[model samples]
Target: MIESLESHPPQPRPIRWWVRACFGLTSPVGQRLYFYTGVGLMAVKYIVEAGFIRLMTGRTLTLLDFVNPLLSSRMQLLQGAPDWAGWALILWSLPFLWIAASMSIRRSADAGLSPWPGMLVLLPIINLPVMLLLAALPHREVERPYGETLGADDVSAAGSALWGIAGGVATGAVAFAMSVLLLESYGAVLFLSTPFFVGAVSAYAYNRPASRDAGSTLAVVMLSVLLSASALLLFALEGFICLLMAMPLAALMAPLGGLIGKAIADQCRGRRSHAMYAVAALPLLAALEFFVVHPHVREVQTSVEIDASPQIVWQNVIAFPDLPEPTEWYFRAGVAAPIGAHIEGHGVGAVRHCRFTTGDFVEPITVWDEPRRLAFDVTEQPEPMFELTPYHEIHPPHLHGTMRSLRGEFRLIELPGGRTRLEGSTWYLLAMWPQEYWIPFSDGIVHRIHQRVLEHVRDVSERSNGPPSRH
Candidate 1:
C-alpha cells in the first residue's frame, strides 16, 4: 500500500503553451518556465526600439548621451520635423502593457490578495517596487488546483544561489549595457531598473530550503555589491566611486530585488523561472523609458517678501557676498549650493557670474528693467552638484549635462509697506526620467539655491538703507 501511495502522488496534466493553468500566474501548482523565455522576449523589445530609434534619427543609438523619452521633444514628433519614433514606440507598447497587466492580475490573485494592486502593472517604473513586494509574499498554505504545492524539494540554496546570482548579474549588466548602448542613458537604468537584477541574484541566493533571514539578507547584500563591483571592473562603469555610491544604491535596492526574484523562482518549477518575469519586465521597462521617464522642462521659482524697496533688493540681486556655511545635509552632502553672485555690468547685456562650490554659472543679462526685473540666459553651465565622498573630483553624467539650467530671472514687486516681493525663478530641464522620484530633490535644491540668494538679498537690502532712488 505504501509503495502504491509513493507511486501515486497527486499528478496534473502536462503543461502546454495554451494551458489554462499557465494563464494564471499564481497557484499552489507547479509549472516549468522554459529557459531563455525571458531573454528572448527582452531581445524582441530591443530590436523594436533599436529599429525605431534608427529609423527616426537615421543613426543607431549609441552610448553617448542620456537617451530617454525626455530627450524626444514634441518638436521631434509633432511640430516641425516629425520623428516617428515616439508614436511608433507608443503604439507598439500597448500589447505588452496588456500582457503585463494580465500577468499581474493572475499573480495577485494567486497571492491571496486582491487584483486591484495589480493595477500597478499599468504604471511604469514605479510599478517595479510594488510588483517586487508582491513577488516576495509567500504562498497561502491552503492549496488550490494549481499543481500540488511547489513540491517539498525545491532547488537547494547551495546549488541555486550561485547560478541565480551569476545569471542575475549578467542580466542586470546586460540591461545596463542596453541602457547605455541601446538607449544612451543611465539614471533609469541604474537607479530605477538595476534593483530587479540584484533581486534576481539575491532570490537565487536564498532559494535553498531552511534559509535564515539574516543570512539571506547578508547574502543579498554581498551579491549586490559583487554585481556592482563587477560592473566597474568588467564593463568600465563608475569606478571606485561605486564602492560607496553604487554599493549604497545596491544595498537599498538589491534586498528588495532578491525577495521578488526568490518569490518568482519559488512559484515556478525551475531554478531559472525568475528570468521569465525579468524578461516580461523589459517591455514595461521600455514603456517607462519612453513614456514615463520621458524628459520634460521643469521651472522652479521662489520668492521672499523683503522689507526694503525694489531698488534696494535689485542692488543685492545683481551682486552679493559669500553665503554662510551650509547647515542642510543635502548641501553638505555635495549638492552645489549657491555661494555668491557678482556681475560685470548693471543693465541688459551685462554678464553676471553666479558662483557655486563646484564652479560658476555664466549668465548674460537678457532683460534688465532697473529696480523691477532682471533676466539672464545661462550662457555657461557648471556641474550640477558634487559628490561629498572623498575625492579630488567626481564626474557623474547627471552632473555634466543631464541637468541644465536654461535661464533665470528676478522680479522685484514693490509691496504696500515699502516691501518688495523678490522672486527668483529658474528654468531647467532634467534629462533623466523617473521625474516623480527626482523632481522633489531637484525642486528642493532649486528652492534652496533661490533661498540662499533671496535671503542674502533680503538681509543686505534690509540691513542697509534703501538704494539711491533710481529715476
Candidate 2:
C-alpha cells in the first residue's frame, strides 16, 4: 500500500543545480552524477575539513590519533573557540550537511521513493541498514521528480571493481592527510569520514543495476575498507590494534556509506569529469570539521545498592583503608584502579584525597549531610591511566589530561529494611571523540573505583558497632 502510494510516474520538472545542491526538488536534474558525482562532491566535503578547518584548532592533528582507540578529545566547549572561528566553523558545516542531504534526496527520488526517506541518510547508527535496504529496492519507472534521467549506464562489474580500487586509494590518502596534516584529530575522521568515503565512493563507482543490491553494496564497501586498511597498514599509518577496533565500524559504516552514495549517484550523471577535483577536496573538509567542530566532553553515571545502613556506610564514605588487589585483567592492564581515601578537616570546607594507582584525586567537601549525603568538588586530579602500551615509557595525550574527575559524591538512600541504597557518582568529563570506544573503559574504571569503596564501607560498617550516621 505504501509503495503503491509513492510509486508515481516521473511527472515533474528537473531539479536545478544550485537549487538541487541546496534542496532536492523542483530544478531539472541534469547529469545524474550518481556514483562519480557523489564521490567527487563527497571529496569536496573532506577537503573543506582538512584545509580551512585546521586553521581553527590550536592542536596538531595526527594520523596516529585516528587509529588510537583511546585518542584524546579536542573539544573546546571548556576553553572556548577563537570567538569568530568557532561560530564560523559551525556555519560552514551548512553546505556540507545540505549537500549530503540533497544527495540522499536525489538518490531516494531516483529509486522512485518518497523524498522523506532521503533524510534517513543523515541519521547515525541505523543509517547503514536503511541505506542498504534503499539500495536494494528496484528502480521505478518515473520522470525522476528530483533530477534529470540519464540513458543506460556503462558501469560494469569490472568498472565497479576499478571504482572500488580508486575510491579506496582516494579514501586512504585523504583520510590520513586530513587527520595527520590538518590536525583534525577528531573521531569523525576515523569513525565517520574514512568508512563513509570508501563506502560511498565504491558504491557510486559500481554505477550498475547490481549496485542496487544489498549484497553488491556490502561487498563493494568491504572491498574498499580492506584495500584502504591494507594501504594504511603498509604505510605504518595504522596498527594491528587499531585495525581490530576499526573492523566493526567498517562493517557498519562502509555499507551504509556505499548505499547512500549509490542512491545519490543514481540520480545524476556527469561527475565523471569533475569527480577528480571534487575528490581532491576531501582532506580540506576533514580538517575543517576538526577545527570548527571540536568534540565536547560528556559525563556518565553508575549506581549500586549496598546492604548496609547509611550510618554505617558514611564512615567509610568519608575515608577508608586500602583496597584489595584487583582480580580483573583490565585493572591489571592499563586502566586506573582505586586504592583508598582519607579526608582532612571536619566540615563543608574539608579536603579529601582518594588515591589511585596512577595518582591521587584531591577533592574538597561541599555538602555534608551525615548518613544521608556527602559531596565534594574535584580541585586537583591525576592521570587517567598508566600506559598498558608495550613500551619503556608510554605517554599519550589522552592518559595525561583528556579525562578529568570534575567532582564526586556519595548518597545514602534509606530503605525500610534497615539497609541503604548506596549510590556513588563521579562527575567526570570525557574529552574524547567517539566516546563509544573509550566510555566503556571509563565507566568500568569508575565502577571499579566505586565498587572498591562501597564494598569496603559495607564491610567496615557491618563489622563494627559504630553509631548510626545521624541526619
Candidate 3:
C-alpha cells in the first residue's frame, strides 16, 4: 500500500513571502557569506573561550580539555533544551553536533524536494549552495497527511523502519563479533581496517531502498564500537598509530556516510540523482580534515647560553650512559629513551635505550642517536585502574608504533666568551583521537606541549652551566 501511494499526485501550496525571500537570497554568493559568517563567529567564540580557560588554568587549554567537562556533564541536559540551545550547544560541543545535524533533517513531505537531498547537508562547503537551492524550491501539499488516519500505505513506513533497524543491528553484531574474535592476535590490523567496512556498508545502505534505515543505524553502531576499540589501541600503543588510524577511517566513512544519507533522502522524496554532487564533496571534506583539522607537527629551535666550554657541554650531551641517572625527564616518565647506541652502525641506525621511572608511568628508549639526538618510542604502558577512563587502557598500536618516531636534537656552538650556545630542536607528531570531534583539542594540546617542552629544555640546559642540580 505504501509503495502504491507513489502514484498519487502532490498538491501545490502557496509559497510564503518570507520563504520566497529566503530562497531569492540563496545564491552562491549569499550562501557563502552566510556560511563564512557563521563559521567566523564560531571561530571567534572558541578563541575567546580558549583564552579565558587558559587564564583560569594558568596553562594553555587544548580542545579536549575544553569539551571534556561538557561531554561528561551537560550533554544530557542539552537533549531536552530548546532548538536555539541545541544549535548553540552544537556550535560549542563536538559530540552534540552529530545529533543536532540528524535532527535538522525534516521529513521530505514538509519540503518539496525528495528526502534524499537532505543528505547534501552532510557535504562540507557544497552543501551550502544545495541548501539554498532547496529553500528556493516550492513546497508540495501532503496527499494523505501522516498520523491523521491509518491507511494501508502506512504499512510500508513501518516495514521500512523495521528492516532498517534489523539490518543495522545484525551488521553491527557481526562487526562486533569479528572485532572480538580478532582482538588478541590481529587486533591492530582489524581495528585499522574497520573504516573500510564502515564505508562499504554505508554506501550499500544508502544505495539500496531496503537497506537505507538499517545502514544508518549500523553505521552509528559500528562507529561507536570502532571508536572504543581504537581508543583502547591508542592507549596501548601511544604514538603515530592513533593519528594514522583516524586518517583511513575518515577518508572512507565520511564521504560514504554522506552518500548513503543523500540516497535515502532521494528515495523518500522522489529526486532523480545526486552523483555529481557527491563526487565533488568527497575531496572537499578530505581537504578540510587535512588543513583545518590536522594538527601541525613542527620542529622548534632555540639557543640557550651556558657559561661552559663547548667541548664540555657537548661531552655531557653526547655521553652514552650505560646506566644514566634517573633524573632525565623522559627516563623518569617511563617512556623509552636512548641510552647505549648511536644513530647508525656508523651513521644512522644506532639504538640507545634509556629508561625513566616517574610515579605515574615509565618510558623506555626506542631510538638513540649520540651527541646530537635522542628518540623514545613507547611500546608498552602501565595498566589503568579504571575501565572507563581514557588513560586506563594500553595505548593502541597506531599510537605506540608511531610515538617511537619522536626525536630531540642538541647542537653546541662555541662563543668568544667562555660560554657555549646550546641550540636544540624537538620533533614529534600529534596523535589525536576522534579526528573530527577533537580537532581543536588536538591543536591546542600540540601547541601547549611544544611550548612547554622547549621552555623546559632551555631552563635545564642553562642551569647545567652551574653546579649539578636536580630537575
Candidate 4:
C-alpha cells in the first residue's frame, strides 16, 4: 500500500495562513488598489516637489528645468541627498516583488504543478488571472525527496541572507557608478530603461521550452533586428535626437523582445534546444557588430553669435578676472571663470584648474584651458549620507587617487556687426560606469549648463552699453 501510494501522486494539502494572506493580497481588487495608490502617491510627490522648486526659483518650472536635476546631479538643487538613495530604492523594491512572487510560487507548488509554471506572472494580459488562480489554489503537502528534508525556516533564512549580501554589493556598485555618471551630466532616461533588459533576460530564461514555435522565432528575430536598427539610428543622430528617439523605441522593443525570446525558446523545443547557445552567442555578435560596424564617437559643432566684438569679448574672456562683475550664473555661483586665475597656459599644453562650488561643497578643477576652456576631472566625492546603513558601510574614495578627467571648453570666432560667435562645448570620457547607464544624463546637464552660460553672456554683453533692462 505504501509503495502504491508513493507511485500515485501525493494528495493536495491545505493552504497555510501565510499563503492564504498572500493570495488575498494579490487578488484583482488588491492589486488594483496597490497600483492606483502607488501612482497617486507618486503623482502627489512630483507635484509638491515641483511646486517647491518653482517657488524657490521665483519662476515657473519648465519641463526641462524640472527633469534636468533629476537627470543630472550637477543640475540638482537639492543639497544633501545621499549618493546611494537611488540605488537603495532599487534594492528595496526588488525584494518586495521577489517575496510576493515566492509566495505565489509556493501556492502554485501546493497545486501539484512545477514552480516554473508560476513564471506565467511574466506574461502580459494573462498574468493577472494566472497569478489569481495560483494564489487561490489549495496547497498540497508531499513527502520531500531524499536529502531535501531541510527545515523551511532555516533554508529561507540562509537564502535571504545570501540574497541580501549579494544585493547590497550589487546596489553599492551600481549606485557608485550611477552617481559618477550623474555628476558627469548624463541623462536619467537610459538609466531608467535598464529594467527592459532585465525583463527580456528573465523571459528568455523562463518562457522558452524545447518545442519550436514559428511565432516566437519570428518575434525574437524581428525584435533583435528592430533593437539593432534603433541602436544604430541613435548612434548616428545628435544627443538630443538620440534621446528623443531612443525612449519610445526602447519601450516598444523591450516587451517585443521578451515575447520574441520566449517564442524562440518555444521554437527550439524537441529540436535540441538552441536557446542557451543563442543566448551565449548574442553577446559575441553584439560585441562584433558594435566595435566593427558602429561609430563610437561622432563630432558636431554649433555657433552662437555674441553682439560684442571678437577682440572685446576675447579681452573679457582672457582677462575674465578683471571683469567688472560676475555676468553669468555659473560665474556668479563660482563654478567657472575666465582664464587668468585658473589656467597657466594660453594653448593646448597650458594647465589650469577650474573650481565648482555649491554652498560648502566644492569640486576642484583638474584641467584648465587658457583663454577658452576648463575641465574638472572629479577624483573623489564625499560619502553620501544614506549609505550609512547598519548592514553595510560605504567609504568615500580619496579625491587625489580617484580623479578621472572632466572636460569643458569655450571657442571664440570673429563675426560681422562687430560681433563674435562664442561657441562653447565640453567633452569627457566617462569611467567607473557603463556608458549606456549615464551618457544621456551627462549630455542633458552639459547642454543645459552650456545654454545657461551662453544666455547669461549674451544678456550681460548686450546690455553693457546701456542700463540693463529686466527682460
TM-score of each: 0.62, 0.55, 0.39, 0.35
Better of 1 and 4 by lDDT: 1
Cα RMSD to the true fold for all candidates: 13.6, 13.4, 13.8, 18.4
Predicted structure 4, TM vs. truth: 0.35
**Which residue pairs clash in candidate 1?**
29-146, 29-147, 70-294, 70-295, 157-208, 199-257, 199-258
Better of 1 and 3 by TM-score: 1
**Residue lDDT tens for model 3, 121-141:** 444334445545543443456
Encode model 4's per-residue lDDT on 1-471: one tens digit a residue. 224333544345355743444333222212222233333433554575556545444334454543332232221332222334333333333333343343433344445454334543432223455655664454455443111212212223234333323322232223223433323222222222232332334344443323224344334433443444343334332122323433453444345434433433332222332323222322332232223321122112235677776555554443234224446553453222322224444544544443233111122445444434433433332211112122332223312122222344457766666666787655434322223323443343345545654655665566663433332
What is candidate 3's TM-score against the reference?
0.39
Candidate maximizing TM-score = 1
Model 2 lDDT at residue 74: 26
Using alpha carbons, what is the TM-score of model 1?
Answer: 0.62
Clashes (N, CA, C under 3 Å) per candidate: 7, 42, 60, 22
For model 3, the stretches where C-alpha displacement exceeds 4 angstroms are 1-103, 107-109, 113-133, 143-297, 300-309, 322-423, 427-466, 469-471
- Candidate 1 structure quality by residue, lDDT tens digits, 11-48: 45565643443343444321122112222344576676
Candidate 4 residue runs with Cα over 4 Å from true position = 1-201, 204-250, 265-274, 282-300, 319-341, 344-350, 357-411, 414-417, 426-446, 462-471
Q: Best lDDT goes to which candidate?
A: 2
Candidate scoring better on lDDT of 2 and 4: 2
Model 2 TM-score relative to the real fold = 0.55
lDDT string for model 2 (139-194, tens) is: 56664355553454555777767766687667667766666544625355556556
